[model samples]
Target chain A: MKFKNFLYIIFLTTYYSFSQENNSSINGDFINNFQSYNDDPLIGAIAPEEKVLNNAYLNVIYTKNNFSIGLRYESYLNALMDFDSEFQGNGIPYRYITYTADGLEVTAGNYYEQFGSGLILRTYEDKGLGIDNAMDGIKLRLNPISGVYLKSFIGRSRTYFNYSEGIIRGVDMEMDINEMLRIENNGSYIFGSSIVSRFQEDNNPKFNLPQNVAAFSNRLNIMHSGFNYYIEYAYKFNDPVGSFSLESNNYAPGKALLSNLSYSKKGIGINIESHWIDHMEFRSERAKEKEFIINYIPTISKQHTYTLLALYPASTQMEGEFGVQADIFYKLKKGSLLGGKYGTKININFSKINAIKNGTSFLNDSLNIRSPFLSYDNDKLYFTDFNIEINKKLDKKTKINFIVSNQKYNKDILEGKTPGEYGTIQSTIGVVDISYKIKKGHTIRIESQALRSKPDPNATKKGDGHWVMLLSEYTISPNWFFSIQDMYNFGNYDQTQRLHYINATFGYIIGSNRFEIGYGKKRAGIFCVGGVCKEVPASNGLNINISSSF
Target chain B: MKRYLLFTILFFFLSQYIFSQEKLPNISVKNLNGKKVNIQDINNEGSPIVLNFWATWCKPCKLELNTIAEDYEDWQDETGVKIIAVSIDDSRSMSKVAPYINSVGWDYEIYLDPNRDLARSLGVSTVPHTFLLNEKKEIVWEHRGYIPGDEHKLLEKIESLVK
Candidate 1:
């Protein structure tokens, strides 16, 4: 079938379905983002090959009964400034048809699935980072009995516009014991297990590889009224990865353990989580870096929304890392001494990650290489964060939130930069947010933030020093909103490097459609989603975004 | 392969026109307490339901929920209704969900769709997406994104259903 003819068939079918005006529904959404770039040598904002770029996506879905079909059309005219150039053309990258009937569901084409905590398998998409690892294949889900769910799939992970060389097959089964037993109870218990295998023909003549690798995960969840606990363990067979030479073989089996416990009652909530993984980098194509990932290793850290605080995010070290995090939330009742007229809320969070102690005697070999890591040790810190925030309403028209945080970041291992280049970054951050209601439908919010970090003596490795930021947002009842924010690096050791990033945004919304336009300077940083990182280059320009759904 | 996918989609589009029904999908999601819930059973005691899909990182979604929370009591009194706020935050931010909800003190029933199965099933591509369901548990209306006064429009829809 010719490509043009295929598109014609799609359009014709869509038109016919719409013209019928029957019980069927055709719904779609479109998002168009256009940006004009400007070059600023000072901040290293280099002009792209194209001065202006547009990234647009359209999703259309038709559904009737237990049958549904959807397709996503993506176009990157000249590709966004920093997006991979391979996405410069227009294509239908995602298309799937699913049918669910008689307690069975089947999908063919493309789909996303996750097993356990995604320690073993996860296929997903993140449009902001232009990463879509969706599997193109057939999937089946069955609910043969009450409270029992079974799912299996066979497919190839997507890599850009093409599919990877590895063939993937997996099956998962989960059962809610309480529900299956037909017990009308307050507490529940669930158990799940998954097995996945991948196959790829070895093409490297110099090294032998495992043509087939399998992984298995077992999970358990127990929930009582206000308490919840979940635990999952995964193991992977030996798989050789990374650069390999004939002189030495680098192959290792992978294993991970993850657990989370939480209790929430009334106005108090507490959660604790820990994870340990070793030799757990699982990917479809071993040669592909930063892409074609097959499994997800989570980074146990708070996702900071503040600009300065987010500058140095912790990236999950897939090779070997042990981490733990705890969060506490408490709310004071209204009319209490410290609660004022409205209740006051307090949140405390702390997280730390460290390099696992290697099994091999490191006296002879340098520990810098990825091969030596096997066991976990608490002495070497990879990242640490302690933060506390308080939110209170002072009066009927005013509210305030204050936050303080201390952090330790190791850039060398996390970013794969030169070892000992910047050593580690130790910093403190403070934030104050205030919201005031001028009238019933009028409101304004102001945010002030400061970040101070210890600077390195080396000029080349010196980090951006003390920073301050202020943001203000004003909104009127329904249709209009405006915001202005600025961040300044005032204490940089090199005065010439100190710069300010100022941005202003305006938005208008009508029904299901929204339009936003912004002009600003975006600092260079790593934007991450689900532990996947993408480099966002520094740019100064005008950005226009419009999205509508029907 | 691409041609095959296109052909499959076309086949479904044509077939759905003849048999499509306006009932909500029975996709499963998890409540804030980690209990599995079927979207089809959200209609409690045959009451109209407001199904809102949101995320913690979405500014507009937060604003919409906050605005609705402030007036939820009056709205419920006027028309007996229930609201189910679904969060599509992936596993990356799922841990913070319970604490975040407590801090806001929203009384609405909340659920987590970590993998977005329900969102995809409902064709929701953006945050702050809302759906209004009749007493029959059928989706009657939906709107995406939110402005400050969207709650008013939502309340009106519920009132019509109540009548």
Candidate 2:
């Protein structure tokens, strides 16, 4: 491993030399201008890692006039971290050269694409999750007429550091009927429809999954004085697979139906969404595991950010579930008793999920498992969380926010590995966040929260109860901050279960760079980004962090 | 069989504990010496630190990092600071980190966290999940995701500890 790293460094040095020469000569004028500026050498760059097993990639973007090109050269040092270093040997992960002009766009090579809320088709990359499904091929967009747009693409799905074998072709058309009709009127409505399909030969004999799968979606947006509404519906056909089923003889194709509706005006906005999925598991390969999920289920819950409040973030079950979400935002005008001088804002959100009921005919079958694949009678996985937040500016130097939330979750299905043991779990979390600016250079924030969950069979211990948390952040101008947080497990089975974890941190900043050191006891939980999350471990240790940019 | 099941459960919990205890990745970075050095060695090296990731074409990244570069010296004087810039630039732009630093005259320590191995291990899904580690090499705090003016917030955290 060490020898390979040395060789890798030599290769990088040679490659860097080559690129430098190439860049210096290709864009002399641009480089000269960029160089003319007193670009400070002390500008921060990416932070240093404690270890460097596999070398990282170099990404470069150059743009001249209406043309722009991006190239990323990646190298995997060693498969020491969670990432697969082998990707480095797979060649450039992403390289796209494109040009845009006169309402027309063209791109060749690898690129990420999303269409109309991304319900039907969304080819995205989440490097953190080691997921990159960028389409490798060609894409074109043209707007011949105002309010009428056209987009088409022919490519293959991105696999692990490479493109898939199947061919994916798609075309999308969107028309703003109001604009097309040239109506200078209020309450305008626009409608659009799109179709995306994937074609691959069915080579697997055991499952005989459909090689050619097509899905379509339609959307409508309406606007009027103080109110706007948007809705979309999408559906996919049945495609049996060995992974989604226990036996080929009992294989069943899957489908999904989704819709979202919303309205907003001035200081108030409301949104409602619903989704029903039946075996809608789509994958690039039939044998892929949880890592190969191609589609996502939009969760319906307030994504808590605080340590204690976010202890249990909801994870969407892809196999099948019925879910709904509602959100409302309203602001009270300033000068009112409730609004205060600077105005106040209020936000409320609720979401729920449940299993879809199924027939009992297969109940006697010993082959069937009750937990992971529970056959529900109503097929409804009901979960709901309602949160209300009121924000008010107490004075010029202070602002306060008070929030309360009630949530119900299905622990048996949500966290349970089997079916018959499935049961619902409920929890409540309330928090108060207050920010006070002591002066121009000093600010302080205090946060207090309480979380309680009902006893379930899966509880860490019998009668597992409630938790309390307190956190404070003090900040001073230029580059100083201090924070301390504690979680007190006050309720539940064991009196000894009352665990207190506390942490304090200090940071210093020089320019765009920052360095911080901290010590504390931490708990274990899941950390999520963009609806996808990973489990984070608990640790009691000292930590150092450094970040900079240039 | 029963004993085996008990062992498997114990193993699962033990692995979880160890995995959670796993610290951030370490790098053997060269300080323009071309001689490799571990990142932990830089602690208490007597300079305020700056760590940033940049590519040739990340406009926002260049803009944010450069904006800080313009005023880095003043920040250093006010707070004893040292900055280290690590390039996520691949083989294509790997050479650019040096010249880019030189041409830009960014007097910060520079290294490479290529293939984003470190970034992934740190749960850095986006370009700027910045962190502030104290002189003890302990990660005091971190923030994931970034927008304009986020640097100011980061500066506040650093400034609070300077005194």
Candidate 3:
């Protein structure tokens, strides 16, 4: 056995042997999914040498009083077809030891943290998307006074199994004005500020590069009885970043401003959010793109739940994009004529993103990078979406939902296509969902959805075509569920390419444990959780998943 | 190799033993009003409580919460239980949570776990994961995923705790 494995065995033995006499507690959870792949030339799916791939994660945490330590073991046996190939090995990538006492906390090792809406610095792990930016080092948090909070950390971002080359140092402080001033029954105002600096060795051969790049952000939040407003502004020093150019060496300052306002009542709510970002692509490595980001630029777009509506999820354009979103939700009173027996709920959402206008000397003169007006060039539209939905309960046994959406996606910009190559796509989607309670423990749900889009006439027919999907799910309360779904591409320009993707699933749950078996021809698409996305390739496979938690 | 196998077997048994006595961690989380409170202090005054981990963007999480909301009043009256919804929204969508809940008219205590500190401590990897705690705050039962009728199972689990 490897030395590390041997050490782990010895440690486990000692811990378990002495656990009966101590009050310390150890708990863990695990999830494993295995798939056997079959290649299909029609949809471009390939099988690896293993023919079968499995992804498993195990997390165990040991807590004793106010101190705890935890670690996660992950394995990707010849990673799945669509997942990142860098995760084709097993390792203990996450481990941390933390102690808290007397309003003070300290952590050493891997940790995830966020400061002020994560505009400037946020480290987190989203295993489904294969994104774990946990910082590896030390963090300290202290609360000296009743309403004051302070935290500071210095670390290197974790990349795959190794740490990044750049060193990250940051501090954040938040103060509650109401609490600090002891103002009773008054509105609450919270103020926060953060500063983050990254230092990377200058290795570029062509031009001068900043060895130390710094970013700072400040935020204010005011809340009073159903009214809330939050705003944050951030600025980054001049640094050369990857902007899809290998030969160009340009340094530019980055800036971002995000704001949110909301007013909510008993049954009605309205919120408006807007943000402007300019040259704000910050990464641990200037040459890296997409994955190794140092800051998170929130996608100010609605996260659609319906399958058809989510087909064209929006990705944030880090270079420069101005976006705004608004949402309104209202509920019809119960026992009213339009409301039926129960209340009817209606939701409307709209969002738009546009490319920011750049100055002529933005690349040549670093000082000219700043734009005061934050103007967006109307000619270049990145994305736009507007959707509305209504949910109603017809009777005690039945419920229904109706939705309609209109979306315009810039294929050239969002998908990284050549400029003016694919131009844009305009799509309209409609969906209907109905669920009926047949008995106390038996229920059935049916979902029908369709998407119609204007395809690019200049290119060969592909995914940008009219599509329809039908899904039916049956559930036996508390234990079992079965589902079958089919998605048909009926408007493919090429006749032979039009096909139906079908899938079936069976699942059982028993007290914190779940087992599922599925057989399906999966479609090629981008699956997004919350703006962060992963591309899943087409596959014909038998899939099995097991998960449990304590 | 045999030693490694033995370690795995021992771990499996040890995990089983620990899980049977699993209780809520004392991780701190923020309430809807932005006040900090420890998870261990969030009891239902000796009544059963349901701890649900969810997010605003998760479809199944919304469905599960909505379904439970429809019968929450009756569930509370019958079992004297409370349901606490913990949102793992993070800073990305944390601003929308308050409005979203108000608009949906869900009458459940909501908490914000921006960094997922509480979630990681509790080993919750995905949303729509729920735990049923008895009067003593010991995790008696848990379930993952939510279908249309999953709330029936939750109600039954709470009833079992009462029994």
Candidate 2, overall lDDT?
0.56
- iRMS of candidate 2, one decimal? 20.0
- Tell me the DockQ of each model, to 2 decimals: 0.36, 0.02, 0.53
- lDDT score for candidate 3 against the true structure: 0.82
Q: Considering TM-score, where higher is better, how would the candidates rank from best to worst?
A: 3, 1, 2
Q: lDDT per residue, candidate 1, B75-163, as tens digits?
A: 88888888899999876667667767765678989999888877876767778899888887777778777655567778888999888
**Selected candidate, larger lDDT, 2 vs 3:** 3
Task: Kindly give the stretch of ten consecutive residues in candidate 1 chain B with the minimal lDDT sum.
Answer: B12-21
lDDT of 2 by residue, A11-114 (tens): 33343345532321010000000000111122211222433333344343333334444444444544223344445442456666566678687878776655
> lDDT of all predictions, in order shown?
0.79, 0.56, 0.82
TM-score-wise, the better of 1 and 3 is 3
How much lDDT does candidate 1 score? 0.79
Candidate 2 Cα misplacement greater than 4 A, ranges: A1-59, A73-92, A127-130, A159-162, A243-253, A359-382, A420-422, A457-464, A490-498, A504-522, A539-550, B1-163
**Per-residue CA lDDT of candidate 2, range B1-163, in tens?**
3343334224333433222122223323333322334565665454335456555334336545655775788878887766666665432233234434443345566767544434433434445445666654444556543333456776777787665
Cα-based RMSD of candidate 2:
16.7
User: Chain B, model 2, TM-score against the native?
Assistant: 0.75
